[model samples]
Target chain A: MIRHVILRVMAKMLIPLILLFALYVQFHGDYGPGGGFQAGVIFGAGIILFALIFGLEPAKAAFPPRVLEVLVAVGLMIYGGTGIAAIVKGGNFLGYGALSHDPVHGQHLGILLVELGVGITVASVMSTIFFHFGGRGRKDV
Target chain B: MIDLIHIFLFTFLAIIAIVVIRMRDLFAAVMLMGIFSLLSASLFTVMDAVDVAFTEASVGAGISTILMLATLSLTTSKESTLYQRPRPLALVVVVLTGAALVYATFDMPRYGDAAAPINHHVADYYIARTMDDTGVPNMVTAILASYRGYDTFGETTVIFTACVGVMLLLGGARTFYRWRRREDAGDPEPRP
Candidate 1:
């Protein structure tokens, strides 16, 4: 596939900005219109764009398939673990108020943790799907 | 004012839907569907559902379009030209379903009716106490992550399952290389 010089340079400039925005969304979600799910998809979209612009091999090298497989499960585990943490702290399942001495603090922390988990799972799964579909059928891929 | 926006968005959405159905080329149809999603997302945003709009824009316009394009690249770009008339039974079924849905909608409460059954139900409590309870200003996130955490967890699980299923069915990086080698060895390209 013939690559475009302008597109590659443009993607290089934009990729980090996209990633930073995704993180901003993930963290600022408590007070704003975005959340883990939206942030994760946006993050994955950035990586997918990287894959599209600079061949699958380079993208895969940057985000290894092996690490992706582990990260996929790890994100879900983080979410589940947060729930269990609340349970062990004597609250009901997913009860955020039990994690800290102050109930509101617990809620804030719990929301942040689970949102991070959701973000990780979503971003990794989306990128993995792209890698699988994007890498298929090419000799060099 | 909102109603006017709703009407305008719906008109464009309907036009896009018809164009998608009438189109023969699969790639063009997929692109049209992306536009359809974008319109719907805008409608959601206009209706004060910013969270839903964000998801729709990212998932519908961003991810799904790219995924569809990737799939298209792997297979034939143009749709098969074997045109077939729509089945009468399918059309009847679709019309019946649409009628049933419209009939059901007539019995539904008016938009944002404070006295509606759902409004008086758990929704009122969620709205009233979410701020005190969750500390998060975004009620949607609070409800999704804390109040209705189990449901969100299940949704994430479902998406995770889908990814695993696709990876299994499609094989992996190694298979693609092997298939290429076979093609280089003068073997016929796999039919699928």
Candidate 2:
């Protein structure tokens, strides 16, 4: 990983922008050709690139495996919670129309939360898989 | 011009596919697969399926390629050379399956046929009512998130299940490494 100054420099410049673009894609999905799935992959790719160029240890330090494991379930819970909230509001399961007084607002909020859940799970799972694969070669487990 | 672009892309795609199949080098094949994914993404973009294209580019080209490369590093990069054994029965089965698939395509509607059963089905209702129902401008998002939310929930669960499966299979790295270390302790150093 060392001795590639150009790659390191370029990576440093691009990683932040890539993560930012992922965020934009996640939030702007309502009006654009992007969403949780795309945004999550992009974000995971960013972190993977960081791990590739700077070494996996630093990446793992930044995003630990334990935290990633927890996040995998947390995202699903958030998604399921949104559905339960709808059920509590007297709407059918996953019916965002009842989340708020205004059905439209409720739909918006539900979509946002659900997408967030997806993004979190996807990003964490991807990074977690990468970490496990990359760490396999190293002596330290 | 667009047709020309499509033709060029498809040509390259075909060439890459052939090369990938014929090449014995696993690394080159993996890289070519990434290119194939990228070309498919471009074709999806040309067809106005930008969301699909995005997913193809990211998951297909990006993550899968990287994962394959990682696996290559852990295993042999070059494919093992096995003696060629031509099985006529296997070839016959594959040829028959391919011919059946091609034959089935004849009864299908032409590309992007507006009157096709799929196009005339609930797609029209979703397109017309997405904005009104979900207040979302992106009809695809509206459909996936609200109209067919239950299905998406199932899909999300599927992804979570995949992660759990992979974790169960690969997450015992530490324990495996520890066991290997214990086994190695009894053996003398055999390699430089």
Top of the candidates by TM-score: 2
Give candidate 1 regions above 4 Å deviation: B83-93, B172-192
- DockQ of all predictions against the true structure, Cα-based: 0.84, 0.77
Model 2: CA > 4 A from native? B176-192
**For candidate 2, lDDT tens digit of each residue in A1-141?**
656899999999999999999999999999999898889899999989999998888888888889999998998888999999999999988999999999989999999999888888898889888888887767765
Per-model TM-score, in order, reads 0.90, 0.94
State in Å the error of residue A29, model 2.
0.5
Can you list the residue pairs that collide in candidate 1? none
lDDT tens readout by residue for model 1, A1-141: 227888878899999999999999999999999989999999999989988888788889999977987888888999999999999999987898999999999999999999999999999999999988887776565
Going through the candidates in order, what is the number of backbone clashes in each? Answer: 0, 0
Q: Across residues B44-156, which tens digit of lDDT does each residue of candidate 2 receive?
A: 99999999999999999999999999999999989998987999999999999999999999999998998999997899999888887789999888888888888888888
Candidate 2: lDDT of A106?
95
Per-residue alpha-carbon lDDT of candidate 1 for residues B77-115, written as tens digits (9 for 90 to 100): 786778689799999999999999999999999987778
Error of 1 at A111 (Å): 0.9
